[model samples]
Target: MSAPERIPPRSVTTAELLAKGELKVRGQIREASNAVLYCSVSYEGQDAFCVYKPVAGERPLWDFPDGTLAQREVAAYEVSEATGWGLVPPTVLRDGPYGEGMCQLWIESAADSELLALVDDEEPADGWKAIGFAEVGEGRTALLVHADDARLRRLAVLDAVINNADRKGGHLLPEGQDRLYGIDHGVTFNAENKLRTLLWGWAGEPLTGEAVETLTTLRDGLASGGPLATRLAELITAAEVDATRARVDALLASGKHPEPSGEWPAIPWPPV
Candidate 1:
């Protein structure tokens, strides 16, 4: 006899499904530094695609403590949620076939969205901001630029707060016209100044009024004994949480987009 057809639940949320559903690994994302499993999670037949990064599969980084990348990814999501920007996809820490891991909803990027570009001109055109020059190959150079979009500006602020060490161009997932999502956040929330990103077009510029307001909210939420602080303590070191608070305070005090520290590489290798 044929098996009965499965029926999906009507009220299950993406977060709920990701946190409580059965995870079946479909394949491995071979390009990732750590083991990234492409899986379908189902609860009461409600299924959705997601990326799962198991803690056991995490590679040791000299800068970051071992076996902490998954937690940091979840912590990044928490901070993103507090910003009310939803920049990171719905992510949760849960047990999968490979044990504990971070499960995030898979976002399909719009094929035609162009947020980063390499132009031959010395300066970027209107509506674009230059991120300095890059060596393409064979001693050739091109001007690297990104869109002067509010979404990217907000992301830059978030990256500053989290001390995101890797914000490659490929990490920016443009969803349709109005929305964008960032992925691969396992290297965030470091206690030190390790902000490496491609979104440096607005460096040294004044923060938007909206950004100031959001930072204020973040400051309050990250106060000692506050909910954000408490949640982050569970994921990262206490010192790292304190550093996050300090970064927010610094942004508020400066009231401007942060410039590269010059101590470390401002942009990650292979920007795209």
Candidate 2:
């Protein structure tokens, strides 16, 4: 007899599914050296898609300790939530196909949507901001640009506060009409100044009143020894946690977007 047809599970909110899901690895993301998997997570008979990165699959870095990237991913989510920007998707630390690691709800966007795109000999389009120009083949330079939306600006602020070391162009994902999602936050919250990204358009710009207020709230939340601070400690070193607090303080004091200090490369290679 033929096998019975399978049934799909019901859908639920991203937060609800991530909190109680039973993760099952379905396929491997071969492009990533680290063992990243595309997973189907079912919770309370509701289904969700997630990206699972196991601790065991993490590759060691000279600067970052081993097996801590998963923790960093979860920590990034906490920061996103604490800032109330909801930039990072719902992510949790859990045992999965390979081992304990970060399991984040996968955000869906338009198949043809390009969060960051390269343009040549074209004026700035409406609703878009030119970040910089990059060299293409044959001595051609292309303008690198991203959506000039408030949601992305909020993410830039979040990246500054978290001391994100890598914010490649591809990290931004379009959600709804006016929403953007940020991912790949495993290299964040370092003790040193490692802010690298393609969001230079807002450099030196003063923080909006609302942005400053949100950051102030984040600062107070971390200082009060709230859940965010406690969770960060479990994922990263105490020194790194301290550094995070310090970064928040610095941002509040400056009250403006930070500029590249030239200590490290200001942008990630393969900008996209």
Candidate 3:
């Protein structure tokens, strides 16, 4: 089958296209744990590729309540937008062919991008940050590392704010030279601490000035009865929203990137 057509730059915003367009499922992204439908959305002659995750297709997890993953995904997008970093693509909660679901604009990752790597050295080289060692094969191990890119550092802060429980390497989508997008956020925003991720390179390090500024913005946006808090209240539980605010406050108070709590696995399984 022919691949879905890419969405070109257009006058209409991607969020509008996703929210109002007619979505036709092109195929199923079988690799995803939940139902991820590759689809094409069109409205007023404008067309774009998107992923639609219907709420009915969600798989129940022991920790998270059932039938809420799709809303969480949308909440993550809202938080991403509040940061003003645009780290997440345009996403909306809309009714699709299958039913109400989360629809997000598709991003075509750059094939030549190299954000992650495994090296034999015990420590990472300059310009690279070490995650930790991983078993590569029989009787061999390698140091897992990711690029010391500012984009990733921003994402790490975002993850911390959202309590992102699964920030695997595969979820990092590098687009052009300057843009990177993170996906698969359905497992985020738990009331408890569940910040599993591979972006631990800056753990315990002081937050950059930019990060502090952005986080302050997030804190204000998440204040009680604030615009962002009001929006998030619709998607996640009141407790979860309050927890998210507390996380932002903690980050701002400490003024440092968080380290592994050791209560949960630092990195996700199938790291890449």
lDDT of each: 0.94, 0.83, 0.94
Per-prediction TM-score, please? Answer: 0.95, 0.89, 0.95
Model 3, span 1-272: residue lDDT tens: 99999997667778888999999999999999999999999987889999999998998899998347889989999999999999988889999999999999999999899999999999899999999999999989999999999999999999999999999999999999999999999999999999999999999999999999999998888888999999999999999999999999999999999999998689999887
Error of 3 at 192 (Å): 0.3
Q: How do the residues 23-94 of candidate 1 rate in per-residue lDDT, one tens digit apiece?
A: 999999998889999999999778899999999999889889734799999999999999999999999999
Off by over 4 Å in 1: 1-10
lDDT of 2 by residue, 115-209 (tens): 67778856658877777778888999888887777887898899998888889877888876767899999988888898999887678889889
With candidate 1 superimposed using the best TM-score fit, by how many Å does residue 118's alpha carbon deviate from the native?
Answer: 0.5
* lDDT, residue 148, candidate 2: 73
Candidate 3's C-alpha runs over 4 A off are 1-11
Off by over 4 Å in 2: 1-16, 112-114, 121-126
Q: What is the C-alpha RMSD of each candidate to the true structure, in Å?
A: 4.1, 5.8, 6.3
Choose 1 or 2, whichever is better by TM-score. 1
